[model samples]
Target: MKLLARLRRAFGASRAAPDGPAPAQDLRLRRAAIPVMAQGTNAWPALHALPIEMLPVVDRPLIHYAVTEALSAGIEELVFIVDRGKRALDEQLDLEVDMLPRGVRAHFVRHNAAQGVGQALLAARHLLDDEACAVLLPGQVTEARPTVLAQLVAQFQRTPGSIFAVEPATPQMTMGSEGLLETAAGDLRLASIRRVATSLDHRPPADARLWSPVGRCILTRAVFDNLEQMADAQSPHTGDLRDVIEAVLRTEPAFSYRYSGRCFDCASPLRWLEANLVQALEHPQLAGEFQHLLRQTAQFVPVNEDLSQAQARALPTGAAAVTGRPRLRLVRS
Candidate 1:
């Protein structure tokens, strides 16, 4: 609720920004920012740092998906915004990033006393340079041919603007998520993004139209000015990407591009598990075994028991489940 109030206060400021976002020009996105810092106030203390950055979506940590998506979009530089206490993410990246292309480079920016997504992006302002930068939240992993980032970049290239890669979603999905966009009809791919919801949105999805962003967007350097200008209007700590987007919309006309991909957001706990299971089921080598395990686990699961508890019971007592273990064979009838 506090977040919603802050978002309202941010937009309610009587004074409007003096300028629009980086003149929606033909700005090339040469870098991508993957802020590993927190978003909103939802804390998952159990999973230190963010679950998406540390935990695995498959054979690699979840951050890999976002990075690969950025690379697929032709981004040569990747900047990781990290908080002081979250060195584990850096160490994990260190161990895994050795396989990246030699031409590609990785850099880190410390998000000092980060409060919200606004501050996280602000910390990386210097590295953003004068051109546009793709902000790829590791949580929003998309399984697509050109990739979610690439799709947004393509739109940005054709019609330069702060590209918000949006997707069709239900009211519940928009709740506690990023601000909802109210767009005016335009081309099939791009629409005039007019406003950002000041409060939690509960709107119905429509005809594959863009209702909300999928945690992937190409933000211009001018957004940094928008963020700074907004600081005086509201509590800087409460300001987030939504507030900055609203600021952008106020002075200039931004566009929302309906991405050609399915984004799996791990920002929500339920979605995190869903992304993992769904992606794992899609893995060629592990699919058959995982499906077999699902079949076995489903048949004997207790109706009233907790699912986690049921899974625990399904495993062999005092040992792991052994494949092809000898069992009693029924004789005759």
Candidate 2:
């Protein structure tokens, strides 16, 4: 009964009852700010080799996936944190202006220096004026149903505090990488992150959850203050955002939602190929057309065999299975 009551309240069904009475004002409409960060000069080097127009996943550029995810979550505005000399990306965005939904605005803020994630976020501080919450989508390709941003936004509505979307990391996932988190308070407080070789000796508790900070994060305005403090304290490194998040975890009530999905680091060649393959499979129209073309081409010639007997070998398997019919099988027996 208690579990059922909790479920009812979670879905807002309990509030509709006559005896329950309406709850306070709906907090769902708290305007959301989305920042898509892509500042590193070597962020996606593989893409540089490919033609600008052709360097895309399915019909859209890889960055479009992040933008689409944010837009799907009802984000009113988008701020792109780009690095200097990213004119190609800006040109691509201008050419594809039609992709933007009506009433949705897009802003591009360039980082003049090769600063870290925290500094890039600080560059866009002007756009986040008066917004109750903001979402930071670091330039990484992630595939999830219901959209990770949408899930984060819903969590923000439920608990109006800083929230981050995390993915549990396995031994294989953290083999060569840093930023392994150790948590206490039932995974509420991140005690520390394993960033160096010497730190691996300190193992996390068995009951302790090991979470990796996925690129997507939803935070309250308090995060801006944290960023400001971090900027003053550190000389700036690659894990600038990580430092800010760890600091916030110590001082404020930071929460995280575990997301079930794989994130692709486009900075690597292997992951980029995987991301493209996944996108190709997920794209409806493009996949359908590609499959159709393959089938049509297969009708005239076998994809692997010689053209001499291609037609005879390419017949439908069902037709060849008819027992009474003359079967065409090039057999050695």
Candidate 3:
């Protein structure tokens, strides 16, 4: 295991040129507008009370994961779609204002009422301006590679249509949800977004492609139009993006890209635990420090182990066990 770790480190240390072709002369396809949907009414107060700015999957905040994903995907501007009374979110943004990347502008849209996700997106329509495409992320932590967003962006650029980030849903995973998908001409179509309460009288086609939409999507400005049409067409549902996407899928040629990563629904305690574990394992830097701390905690006296007994003693104060156990708490006198 140690040898494998050393080999992995050696390979990671060797840098490679950036992916994709040289920058086009125009250097601009369509400026990406990212809108992070964060509704105050639905947010768990306890989760909200926890410093979301400091809430880490591994050591990075949940919001940071989404923002970083967008920025890495060449998104030019970010607009956070929040609801009124969400002062916590505002404070978080202020606290991390200095950490924002240079040249990337940030904006916020606060909906006056607890509207639907479509309404929240509609609230930020002014920010869209002439942006041909936009990326919308549900403000929650998910385990995905940085290239996940990049891949979606590339697909959008090539197709100039709405793209949804999805994962293949097996029978085990689709227990509580409908798994009906239709494919034609290499494009995946969402047939229905039904609940378990509804009877599945219409089963999916035998050769139907199976994909479950994660809460992230790359959409064209047409989404804004769709939202408006949806609002006028039906009553709002406290910012449910699923409804909006369903409406759009009926009218537009929505495509799906199968993302290869685990996703965490951090709104629940169970999912949050899963997120932390997955992130800790995937984060290279954190894993390295953790392994080193474990060796010290075990009193491994090797030539390469630089920490003295005194230093090792202090390391336990902050280190969690490798066996998925919580850190030992020391009550102060």
Candidate 4:
């Protein structure tokens, strides 16, 4: 009963009532800030080989997925924070979206040099105009059926504080993650967050799963105010936005909405290949044509092999998926 009451207060307040989100214009007027600048490390050399957002995923550019998903969630304005040399992404955007959704607008904020995610976001502060905004990391691609982006936006409309989308992290998938969430006793709403560190042996109670922030958030002006203060103070982890979020949890009350779905970190080679294969296998238009091929590839190799080194390189370039090429199985475990 307490849980029911808590949920009612969160979602059934007079503003939200008993039905859907507040209104279309409430979401349409809001903006989404996507930070795209990343120092490409050799661990994943493909990022440096092409504009990270232009990297092919399921035969489509990565940014296409981000933009489409944002549009689906009713966010009409997008601010892309990019580094100086990364203007190539802007060109791709121009050529890709033939027509912007009714009132949607796309703008770019360029960083003079390579900096951390926090700085990239800070660069887009002018575009925010002191309103609440959504922050989406351009590197991760989520393929949830109902689209978790919509869920995050809905929560923001109802509660309107700093809300982040988090999913349970397996032991093996915890490397290089944003942060883990500590939820209230029996609820998934965030109570605290632990930032990623070089070394740590901490473990969560069995009732609580280690939840990683997947670069999707609804942050209010208060959070932005804190970000400005941190940017001015030159705080550590200011370069990484997750750390900035950790700093927010110190004084502000932030919440987490659990997403039990697939989210791939395309910046990672293994996950990137897996994301392509999974998304391709499920593509509505291409799935039937490629089903046999992908299934065959899944059986050809052991699940543990490093497909990134041997198989991913030998696969046909973007041309194959875009046009046509010799058939080959593409699979990931």
Candidate 5:
């Protein structure tokens, strides 16, 4: 448990909130939007040539989890909002499309180099028309039996406007997270939110409480309308998706579900590495090996001991059999 706790924090694992109420009716959202503009990726050299979404978790790409979570939540159509400079995203989509299930549809559309996520979504408004849909961001991945989006979709039959996956902003995580001011709903894990303060906000509310908006959110036509209106105004400060959602919250009833699942945000290279390490601990084939590696403590090899024995005891399973890497040598110290 201590090892897991350490790794979870290392990877930015989200805190669980109370579970939302059950589905009032059968709500199967058919469409989902995956925005891949890859904003602010230049800071990390790994993303300079490779698409961030295509970055691998354990045995699968970041996009793989997004697609699986959408599919598991009953989304039949997937729209990828791409940018002109993202040819790698297109090629990855080409490979991803063929791998999708027969009935699942994957299509990519370009935004006119939009300013933020809200604007990127407006570019594909025609495809979705006026229906409730799910949105998944690639850099954030969550593991739950009923995927995070599925949980939101199940509750959509009642709320039907917008629902966001949210987590408790514990004291340890309050410093850098985006803040939200929320009023609690009837359910312990559900809340009604009207304000969202993004990092771009220069003057955020003084009392704004932090509730990190996990990358997964459910959207409706009202959200699109708000985005369109905001776009038409041609405001220089076209805010991100959180702004559009906050607008929707003002008029319609939107919920923030404190999902019971664990989420990992791979927003940076260091965090991405942590995500891989944490996920591999639970991976079917890698868990035992990872645990074995974690349990090992540093020790010096005896001068006369067999080198193979030292390698087997100190290195991870596969690493012990590799070549060309440095080996431990005892100089009778």
Candidate 6:
């Protein structure tokens, strides 16, 4: 038994336990993973002209939020897994590395042929050999009060295992994506993850508050072992991280840390536009810019309090309505 384990370690194969030196506590973050040649057209092709990983959010690349969040979580080292076609991403990271907060180190690994999340993680298996680490998706954006990354890390520290950051799903979101997760009634751990299409034409589930996985998580070697098992057995759920998590739940201790914050799905076209609008509204310096644009494009209605979609569109303001529906109403302070 011992001899077989020795051979697996010799070849750098995934062992049930950590093989190499454990990564330092402060270096526990794995940056976003995007395939080398992303299949199909992106939701926002023009915005994604520079790889989706490099798409801009506010004034910086989308990944910057994830990196900044990781740094804020006290993680000093980050591993970004990329593919051959993403050389632009590498160049961007190089230029930004110097500006990184002190004591932080970032490394990029090329997984050009990576087919799924498992393959991507396996590429950086060396870095994740540590006992615990967080994985952040570059394209996913959040507008949380305490910051989702900080909350996730704190949960992982308390729970001491895999922790997934989940937020309440919206009707539009449920209609447009796969792997909508259902959590247990009380404990809030995942109950089941249903594979469904996120098409608006389809009927959205009636659940008022379904917890959806938003791509930020703290992972341990146990999760990697499941990935390895899936790869070895050629399981159908090899690429999707949610499927892998479902498998993990059957064996290990996995917890869902529900956050009461707004999360944006940047992977979808319509949602991406909504996220941009929300971010623009929240930008301290860009408030005036957004107001100026709103005046030109739509009627600006100033309300005494925050109004819902139904209420905002009903009120009348002077200018011509915008190109799209809802007319971009601006609520007054």
Instruction: Identify the leading candidate in terms of TM-score.
Output: 4
Give a tens-digit lDDT track for model 2, residues 186-216: 5443233322221334566665556667777
- Best prediction by lDDT: 5
lDDT of 4 by residue, 11-88 (tens): 874555657665554443268887766446565767665766788897788877887778777887888777666557
- Residue 241 deviation, candidate 4, in Å? 3.4
Q: Which ten residues in a row have the lowest lDDT in candidate 6?
A: 32-41
After the best TM-score superposition of candidate 1, give how far the Cα of residue 214 lies from its true spot, in angstroms. 1.6
The candidate with the higher lDDT, 1 or 5, is 5
Error of 2 at 216 (Å): 0.7
For residue 320, model 6's alpha carbon misses the true position, in angstroms, by: 17
Query: TM-score for all predictions?
Result: 0.72, 0.68, 0.67, 0.74, 0.73, 0.69
Q: Cα miss at 158, model 4 (Å)?
A: 2.7
Model 3 segments more than 4 A misplaced: 1-55, 171-202, 236-240, 292-333
Superposition-based RMSD of candidate 6 using all C-alpha atoms, in angstroms: 10.1
lDDT of every model, 2 decimals: 0.70, 0.61, 0.59, 0.69, 0.72, 0.63
User: Where does candidate 6 stray beyond 4 Å?
Assistant: 1-44, 47-50, 169-171, 186-210, 237-239, 292-333
Per-residue lDDT of model 3, residues 113-223, tens digit only? 456566767787887745555555544566566557676776666666666677665665456553233443234432232221111344555645556666677666677
Clashes (backbone N, CA, C under 3 Å), per candidate, total 0, 0, 2, 0, 0, 4
Over 135-248, each residue of candidate 1 has an lDDT whose tens digit, in order, gives 887756787767888888888888777888887656676656657777754456788876776334434235324367777888776778877767656744542357657757
Candidate 5: worst-modelled 10 consecutive residues by lDDT = 199-208
Question: Candidate 6 on 199-277: residue-level lDDT in tens?
Answer: 3445445642355677777777787777777778776653345655765665676766786576775667776777778
